[model samples]
Target chain A: MAVHHKILGVATLLYLLVFFIHVLYFSLKKERVLAVAWMIIYATICVHTLGIVLRWIESYRMGVGHVPLANFYESLIFFAWSVTFILVVMRKKISYPVITMCASLASLFLMGYASISPSVEKNIQPLIPALQSNWLHVHVVTCFIAYAAFVISFICGSLYFVEWKGVIPPKAVLEDINYRSVIVGFYMLSAGILTGAVWAHYAWGSYWSWDPKETWSLITWIIYALFLHARMVRGWREKRIALISIIGFISVVFTYFGVNFILSGLHSYAT
Target chain B: MTLCTLRRLLSFVKEKKTIRLPDEDRLSRMDFHSYVPGKGLGETVGILTKHYRLAVNGEQGAVLERGKLSRYGVFIIHTSIIVILAGSFTGLLFGYRGFVTLKVGETKDRLTLRGKTAAEIPLGFALTCKDFRVNFYPTGEPKDYVSTVEIIENGKVVLGKEIRVNDPLSYKGIRFYQSNYGSAPVFFFNVGGEKIILTEREVFRKNDLLMMVARFEGKVHDFGPGVLVAYLDNGEPKAAWFLKSVDRLREQKLQGVKVSLVDIQEQPYTGLEVSRDPGVFIVWAGFALMLLGLYVNFFLQHRRIYLLRVSEGLLVAGMASRNREDFKKEFEKLTEEINGRTS
Candidate 1:
């Protein structure tokens, strides 16, 4: 198997273990072991990154000569890598082990899709004429980074909601952390769209084409826009805004992977 | 004697009716009516009615406004829509998109059209592909396609550049792009009663009255390509309309001219897209403004912290903002830093 495949397998197994441990910890109320679980998640993420870089090198050997973001398998791996990377960054300010589970779960889902999904082919392919550009690296990496950040905020937002409505128990610290994560995510998302627009204009003749990918991206941006408006203009409570953030992140997921797999248009290259 | 005869001939040719008359008056009046105000007003009104509006206001007064009316959240949405429309229109009206496919030595006069139809035509000058090359991966997937092209005007090459997918060539308000690739049939021509057997190495001029002959090169022994002939007659040109496979010549006669399609060659060519946009700078500026707006909206949270001195050393501080938790945390951190610095 390829290095990427090995890393993916490892990441998947680790993520599943982490998920099981999270459930067991939550049920058994073993909060102290949560830190150890987070460390395990972080280590798996590092391994995933190493695997991606190695895969990139492997593509160069195969003469593809582009980043590992050309197709569904590579993109899924990238998505997992980005989500984990962002989660690690947020951990410093958040100081909570619970959110690590979200990253682990997302990684697990990506690995599962890569492993079992017949539609997703795990082989290095050639770059199309349209994708044969240096912008491929800059455009794709930045967008996924921003997406990862959004995923983090979304996870935190779910926690905020559960706590806010007394469904899980209100924790002010957790809610505040979730709100901050969303703010960071929104900023990165804005940057990602801008970068993508610039890349589109450079690659294609137009900046925005109302293609399904572009439309859904705008839709994702709009959801976040509404989240911002609710936070700033409407003076929304953190709990409600967090719930909206979760909803917004779900839309982001749909926009990133769902748009590629389910919907077809200019972004079909991603699929 | 020569002068007198010349003067007589000039005088006879000069007539008042031929110089100016009733017909000229009517034609001038028609031109004037075409430019009259009433005719254009209806068109202007039609355009005015198509404009949309967006507005936003609190109970007291308007906060944001644009277009026809004001509504909350309309500012961002409408601006975004306008931005999108403006970008799209700029792309459609001024944006040029076409592809150029050239074999190893073959050159093309025009790029192939892509995207919307109306946006594909070249606004000014013609682009000719001088060269095209494709680098392939070991697994048979294409790595890159590069096209070398020149902008020609009045039979002279004005500019020359090589363009790739990300790195497009732009000169004098036009851009050339390396877009796609495919295998095109190369043909040989025989003209002027001489067998001019040219392979993939010869370059042919457009609308030239030249006979052609083509053949298959590789050992694949497959059915080959066809030959096309374009001829110029009395300052007007006509193209031969027929497709002949390899080893098969189609003979046709047009306007008493004998034409035959010889052979066809299959050669790989690169496709290039061309475009020209005058409003691209404005669109880029709009993107910058949008990014600025988002940055300000996200990073800069409006918070005011006021401090009032009580008696002696006691002081009370208050904050008026929506993000009370963030404000409180920042306030505490600031006060701690200040105390540490003062102490």
Candidate 2:
């Protein structure tokens, strides 16, 4: 087995452990277990970061030197990494245990699917000429960061609709997180779309091809824009905004996965 | 689609009417920014004012430029959307995308437009394909495709360039991109002391005999480049491989006829996508503006702090257009500093 795979497998196991510990913390309300879970999360993130870096180095060793942001497996790994990394960074700000639990669970889902799915290709592949541009770095990074933010927002928004049993943050805090994450996500998604357009212009000689991926990204952007306008300008609160947030995240998932698998376009290499 | 979005944004901004400052009571005195002596004191202060400056009515302190220019961020974003739409509109009206295929040592002066209207258009100057090359990785994946081309204007070579996937050759606002390539192999053969030339999938015919090139293979059993030839022997179809190596070609007999493979020339054709969009720079400019606008809109806010001279000491009140929670914390910190300095 690959060194990176082994390290990432350890990280994945630790993530599962973190989820169980979070569930325990919710029921028992023990600070010690929560602290242990946070420490484990920190350690898992470090190991996860190492695994990603090692995969990049292994690609270079294979003589096909390129960043790990080139295929489905790498993308899934990076997506999970971005979610956990962001959650850790924002852990102090969003101190609610449920938020952490949900965010970690989301990352775990991505990591699990990436590792166990037969459809996902784990081998490092050579970069195609179209993907050989430097814009790919900015495009994929910004897009994934935006997706991670939306994931956080989706968790908060879904929590807003649920009746919590114990130790959950107030509805106001949940709504605030939903709003703030959408703002961060909106900016990053805009940057991602613009960078993608620039790269496409260089490679295909057309900035806007109305390809399925491009069209779906635009649709996702419009949905988020609607969410922002309704929240900020229209002074929308609680249920409506939360629903928009959930729907916006659905659009995001469709853009990222559905477009790649169900439809064909310039971004077919991602599949 | 862009136009419709622009319309919606314009109406949204217009419907909001203008920027509003929060009304707070318990502050008696006002400053030079359009203060009215009524229930709504300081209502017009900083209202519809594009410039921001410190105004002291009874006391003077410090003046800070708290990103007042950021208020224009919305304007900048709206105009950027318009500029982007206009740029794309210009491209739609004037720009054209076409494709031209040129074999090595071939020149063409026309291109066929690629779209619903598939029409031929003149290139104004002839483009000649001098050479074509492709490189592959050890895994047999294509690394790059390059096409060497020269521009011929009035029978004179003006410019020569090598075009690749991301690197295009441009002249007179028109660009040529290396889009694709294909093998166009030429083979020379001698049959019964007569020389004949053939290419892949070409048929050579003589009296009562016919031969056709079936396919060209880069390798056959680790031997070098070879060709598969199909011929008719008394109306019976038979196929055989012809190797480039002289020893391997010498052993091959074509249905009782002594045919020898003389030479093989592998000439590939380069597929070039030609395009000219005059509004590309405008579109880039719009992108820059959009990024700047978004940064300002997300990071900066319009804030106001009013210090009124009362009978006791001073009354301080603040207002912010966005992120009220953060602005409130900042307002508290600033007020604390003022109290510390004054007392």
Candidate 3:
């Protein structure tokens, strides 16, 4: 019932609207409908950003006084925001409404899960001693950006093989976007892992402890690394490269959610 | 030899070698030996290579052009992985991690190593825990665990700091992190005419009655501060609370023995994780090199164009390490520029 939650709820509804409008744009082939969807997305993002900032202010009011990147619910919100933000930024380069709809659906799912999940704690809580550091902001921001890039790439890569019958862009365009997003994701993931290591060293006196979360992150990194090597060095294309991109996103998902939910480790705090 | 065979064989000869035939023709007949471009090349190619920061090499019969950025990027990235592994390996070999628990006002110069076999190592300097304080939120979740510690060397107080989670104390290349904390409760007991003292986790035995001070509780059912005492009866452990604020339980009789609580005090002990990793900086260096290498590899392209003398004027073939489609367009534009300049 807080202001920020209401704002986010409104944003979520707008996102659903955006998805429907995208569908309309595709079915009717109306550029006006597509333009309307873009306009709604921009407003949705603004409201979404306001909600995030307001939640940060709410945490301060609650005396926690930390960034909103502390818990599972907050992370989901940030993930949704990052996905939409990245999609909009890359809108000019990738003007495919179908991709936008895929992204919108992804963000809706994240926001919906954050709001509807019974396990997620929505209240602002004080950080544990270990997470009370500046590195949390750096590490979480970079990792989510990387995840957003991968999400976009997953959309493009999946559409490449679908039999859309002229509804989708050329395979070359999708492939290029996939490749570019993977490159961005790879670099951000590397930075995220590095920052995590540095923060761990400061807090626990060990940089690399084969914790499940850390191991899964390394696995994700390796998968992406393989993707890059196969595409860039081995000159793989089309289905093979698309398959690797999808697989890499799967690893990313496992690292982000599976490790937090199923495995017990130092990152159990995330759960 | 064919281009693929030559490329595979040349992989062993040069670290940064690229050979591809975008469109193969009689131009492939030109005998080509891949040179590690930066190492050996013609002065003309070398000058252009340095000026453009591109990779250009002179083979036996043709001149090959490629962006040196990708080559060096691959080289740097691969080498950085080796460097990181080596750094961590060095840490594993040379570094030591140990733990020490210091009660307030206690000093220790040795720590027990963390591994299968417990071994103690000298810390070179003694560290004393001045105080251990833990702050908690109203929700009872701990917000901070801080230990005020001081380092002493040969009767001199050298360094002092308050170490907390994510904020550690470093002295002589060894870091001390505030890893954990526990309460060290002290209890004084008077049984009949004998007086005894016990602290947290300490066992006291007299006449087959085994007692241990388990922990100190702030409020036990609103009876005020008390100590939880565990007693072994018939080899089964049973715990009972002894309240300092209550007169009846303060001097309770157990097993025909008069056991009276005299006074109790609770102090906190700080648990510090100690480590000295000399290779951490090397690992950081590897991280820096890797970021640099990745930037080049992702954002830059490696283009290799081969020129051969032909019956009409000249023959040109081109390829790229990655982004082949984009390179096709670039190659076309470049060849047009070449023809325009010559015409």
Candidate 4:
């Protein structure tokens, strides 16, 4: 069962087009077209789910006997899917079409990179000795899930910043939602780091070796720590904190992908 | 005069015994105690001085008073330091790590110790590799490597299991992990004048001293390096010695000892990482505490909802923290529900 990467690729591209349409409709103030765009986004989400499941099956056939998270490309696809999943669920309670648009754009970028980039090979690889444990499933899935949640919060935070600076119309309702998302994201990120650390201790015999991945992750944690402190203690309002949250997410990106490609460390397989 | 001569003879005998030749007496006599004289004395003085000082100065003046230090301030600093120190120290002291490499159908007794200057097996029992295998992905990227290992104690195989990277073989409080792969050179020996080429098929026990007894023609020769002693019962082979060099084999004859070097074969095998960490549970506990602290700190916002009765059966409500806008909306909805019921 070969992974239908081409099918997934096409479906992702179609979703990207739909996301752009949503943006165009919102900018044009066309309510009917915006509703249509939302429906298309939902359909695209189902397709994305199918693509992920298909890739997982293909991995089994390829005899990796592991999840499709052995490398950066698979992780990027997972991240994009997770973000879209959260955004769709969030859209039910919050009426923030613009934030959704940003998330979709991020997801599209991940898919586009996976599909187009030569360095990112979209094939099922066998699990290395370090990744042959059951913890791989639990740890990698949880970490990426948390990462996806952060990405969503990052999008919302970016939107809040734009509205606060009057780049876009003020949406105070979305600002509170954005803060809530960040709080949730921060909690998940903490969980992700803790899980990864525990797993590392078991696999490598050392809990923290100050590897590039671990260091950057701690840096990411500290950034969110500063955001939390500013919000809870300093009584700083939403706009500045939201901007900081976005900055934190960028660090998360560097920690996850940049550290793997640009820097050499124990987590070379992650690249 | 006879008694004086006898005393002189005894003194002369004592001096002769003391001034023995190096080859005749192989041992050296020196004052070993001079190496570390002041160390023991310093420790003794340190303990005695502290004890006497404590006795002289009393607890009242020597110990810090509770009133002098703020409780909250002390708690914050001390607790954080204790947590960090406990985590680091526990991780360092009780952590044992090493690596082992073995080819298919081969067994290894010692694992390469990591982060240590000397070779030491941290585990109580010995581990022997039984088999090693590697599988590749369809994309041609090398995938999994596994090593089958047996836990041995007193020549008895207690447990047999295959250990991979994430999936380790745990026995007797130790784990073996399949980590690396490489090829090494193996040498052959021709003992007892019988031609035997030691190839990749031969397994040499690490640090094992084998006695190679050989007979060549009529002369007998005995040669050895360290514990590996070789005795030729009959050898008149004109005693030629050869040293295996990097580029070319150097031949020399030293004291009529003949040694011939043969082939060097590369043996490919897999490497396994072994570890036994008693501090892992403590590190895991720390992780649990950290996660719990984060969850409580972030997710469970300190929300305080207050309701006050004022002005003829009217209720005023307020929240102290978190999602105030949502709280306000909920409070309004609750008021509306109450009003509807009352009316």
Candidate 5:
């Protein structure tokens, strides 16, 4: 209980590190060990999922009985879980280990940063008055899923530019995947924003207070909307659309983490 | 094709919005994909009227169209957004939020509007705080603070209910939420046959013998709440630890004193937030509609088909929604089905 987060954090990293090894082993050479890698990916996902559930159980045992998604430390673990989940689900359809590597790398960084950060509170704190709602689960889960989706699209878009056909997927496939992931991310993040607004209205008597978190979420939403619109335009080429995808994911990252660290609002508990 | 199938298809077409299609026996050509310059008038009209609506169109000429959702889906999403915006604006224009603080046994009819400057507004009906209580968890964190309130209209008790943090009481047009609570220690004493309640540090003079509750102990010796009373005679004060609810005057009080325990009360003041928003229901409706619309827009894929009446045969062209390639395979299958049936 004293270091439940520490254990989960290390578990996430170990999962990421092991998955990354498979990604490296398969991507460079023409060896189709995807079955082995596929099984390994699910195994890592199970371990990562176990870690998250353990954290949740620990919070409940701590008498908080709330989801372990109230702060930055917990959200980072969730972010890693989401990314790995997406990776495993996507692996069956897209024949690319590079995407897994990219996703795992991002998860690795998030989990590592969360585990090493001295500022983030790792303890299972009781839910504050404003945070005691079912909406906490809905908003945080949906938001992290959106973030996870965007992270996948960001990897696809980045690889579309850096290495078009050698190890990563081709330009057309990556572009298609990027657009599709953005579509999913857009819907999820929109749901998250609406649920957060409703929760805010219930707790604080106002729905949209233009708080830093709200503003940044709106910004991220607008950017993705623009990306979708640009995708429809005949003039916007593949590279331009890919660039927008990356930009949108960057904005998503900022909205997820930067707002908590840099701005103060009713959502300050997320810090 | 069989006569029964032809009749069913024809009947279906007749029930739909009628439009003249290029004749199946058109002059020299029947194509599904190639477009002629419309040496005839029907071809021009068919091409010109393609954009009238958002639904599939199939004709006797074997032209099957789809992707109606492709265009209308975006419109639904956009219109739902407008609806949500309208609902929000309605809330902003008509909604009012305010709060009132009520102590036990106090009645209030006015609320202070929540803003930078406090403005008192009448609630048109009186609200009485019958009682307020706080429950704490084993960890010392507050579990709940509940207020039992009564709504009085024309001196008649119309409604009475307990309101907690997440649960609110609604009457007529407004809602009252138990937002907060606070307690203040007070000492109850009988002095010279006249009972008086003195708050902490408050002094009351009875028969020129000044008496005051100088301090309070929330708990003393685990026997429950006790207070220190200061009695002054010519500026020379006598202090005693008095449990206002217990008969402790003889045990810890000054000898020959007439003062005795009446009761010690921790008067609880409940903070109630009053809100009335006519647009909340509309806003929720809009949210539901938007969610439904987004689901339709994303989950439903549309496909369209074009048929060209050419000299060689019927040439067919296909289109998929969102420019996704996976739909092209579906379109190919549809085209193959039409070819197998018509040819």
Candidate 6:
């Protein structure tokens, strides 16, 4: 087994454990114990980061020598890392145990899928000619960060619709979070799309080919565009905004996965 | 598609309503806070107006610079999107993409479109394929595909280029991309001590010996570029095969004729994808606009603090477009200064 996989597997288990512990502590009226849970989640994120770095080093040792972000397994691990990093950084401001649990669950799910799925190859391999560009870093990092922001916004919106149900923060705070996180997501998605377009033009002859992935990305953007525009509507309020956030996140998931697995396009190799 | 995007923009416009603070009653609702040293309502408004870069109209006021910057951000962002959409529209109106296949030394005046209902579009000038070559990696993978081409206008050379993937040749606003490559077989035969070389699909006949190459393969039992050729032996058709490699040429003699490949004369055909997009610049400019607008819109928050004369000390209230917590700190500072001043 790879070193990163072993570490990340342990990290995934601990993430779930921390998530459960946070929920249990919150339920039992022991709010301070959730601090311990928070620390453990932070430490888990550190371990995850180290595991990714070690995998990068391992790839270098194997002469592949590229960032651990080129394939399904690698990108999923990155997805997990991004979620954990963002959630941990947001721990202070948002400070909701439910949010942390959801984030940890998301990371754990991704790591678990990456490890267990037969379709995902965990081995480090040389990048093909098409991926050998500086834009790989720009495109993937911006994209994953945007994805993580959407995940955060989705969690906030989901919790809001349920009225937080003994969650730490007030409903207004969650609504604020839902709005701010989506703005961050919108900006990052724009940056990601622009960078991806630049990269596409660099590798392929065309910038926007309406490939399934690109088309899905555009659809996701339009959904979010509607979400942003809905904020400007005179009578539309928080609940409607939260609903749009939920819908926009669903579009995000479909754009990221459905376009890869179900639809045939130029980005099939990315899957 | 254009109509769809245009409708989105139209709805965006319909969604926004102009906000303004124009009177004392509106000022009351704004939760005006902070007290400045002044004579009365008129003097207090003067001090407040002096401190803030405001556009005051009939007691309703807005901060000038921040409001302008925020509005500029909104303008730039929306305009950039519209410009991008318009650029795509112009591209669809004027741009056409098609591919041209050329054999070595073959001059083609038009490119073939690839689709269900494809058509040949003329370039108005001839393009000649001078050379085609490929560089290989150590693992025998193709590192680069290069095609040397020359443009011929009115039987005169205008431009010569060696194009590669991502590095296309542009002439008269049309781009020629090196998209693909291949080779055809060329056969050299020595029949009765007479030497002659013939390209694929070209018939060679001398005194009842009519010969033509059927096809060329890179490997026929690892023979390396085996040329399949057919000959009319006294008008009775017969077929023979020979390798392009010189070492393997003597190994297979086709019925008293020493046939060898002149390296199979690998007439590599360069697949040049030609396109002309006139609105590409508008699209690029739109991207530039988006970068600037996004930075302003996301990073810069418009913070406002309205001051209204009240029965007690001036009631302080504040609002920011984003980061209300950070704005709270600044709002406190403003109120502290106003509270300390002599009113």
Model 2 C-alpha lDDT per residue in residues B1-343, reported as the tens digit of each score: 4565566567668945543322334333322122212212132223212333553322222222356656667667767888888899888899999999888888999999999999999999999999998878899998888899999999999999989888888999898988888867788888777898787777988766689889887777788888888999889998887888748564466766777778888667999989999988889889889888888887788776664433444455655777778877776666555545434
Task: Please provide, for model 1 over A1-271, each residue's C-alpha lDDT reduced to its tens digit, 9 standing for 90 to 100.
Answer: 8877787788778889888877777767776667667778777877787788888888888766568898888888888888777777766666555677666787789878888898888888878877766667767777788777777777777776453232243466666666676666666666677677777777776666688877887788888878866865698866787778888888888887778868888788777
Q: Is candidate 1 or candidate 6 better by TM-score?
A: 6
- Model 3 stretches astray by more than 4 angstroms: B1-67, B138-140, B187-264, B303-320, B324-343
**What are the runs in model 4 whose C-alpha is more than 4 Å off?**
A1-3, A62-65, A92-94, A156-175, B1-85, B101-112, B116-122, B136-143, B192-263, B301-311, B314-320, B333-343
- TM-score preference between candidates 5 and 6, better one: 6
**Against the true structure, what is model 5's DockQ?**
0.22
What interface RMSD, in Å and to 1 decimal, does model 1 have? 2.2
CA-lDDT, candidates in order: 0.61, 0.81, 0.82, 0.60, 0.72, 0.75
Question: What lDDT score is found at residue A50 in candidate 2?
Answer: 96
TM-score of 4: 0.71
Task: List, residue by residue over A160-236, the lDDT tens digit for candidate 3.
Answer: 88977758889989998998888888998898898989899998899899999889889999998988878766989
TM-score ranking from best candidate downward: 2, 3, 6, 5, 4, 1
Pairs of residues at least 3 apart in sequence or in different chains that clash in candidate 2: none
Candidate number with greatest TM-score: 2
In model 4, chain B matches the true chain B with a TM-score of: 0.55
Report model 3's TM-score to 2 decimal places. 0.77
Which residue window of length 10 is worst by lDDT in model 6 chain B? B56-65
Candidate topping DockQ: 3
Tens-digit per-residue lDDT, B254-327, candidate 3: 55567788888767788999999999999988888898988888878876656544344445555577777677
After superposition, candidate 1 runs with Cα above 4 Å error: A61-65, A92-97, A156-178, A238-243, B1-123, B153-155, B183-258, B265-270, B303-310, B314-323, B337-343
Residue pairs clashing, model 3: B55-B68
A147-262 per-residue lDDT for model 2 (tens digits): 99999999988998899668668998999888878878988898999999988887898889999989999999999988977876799999999999999999999999999899
Among these predictions, the greatest lDDT belongs to 3
Q: Candidate 3: what is its chain A TM-score?
A: 0.98
For the candidates in turn, chain A alone yields TM-scores of: 0.89, 0.98, 0.98, 0.91, 0.92, 0.95
Please state the i-RMS of candidate 4: 2.5
lDDT-wise, the better of 4 and 6 is 6
TM-score comparison, 2 vs 6, better candidate = 2
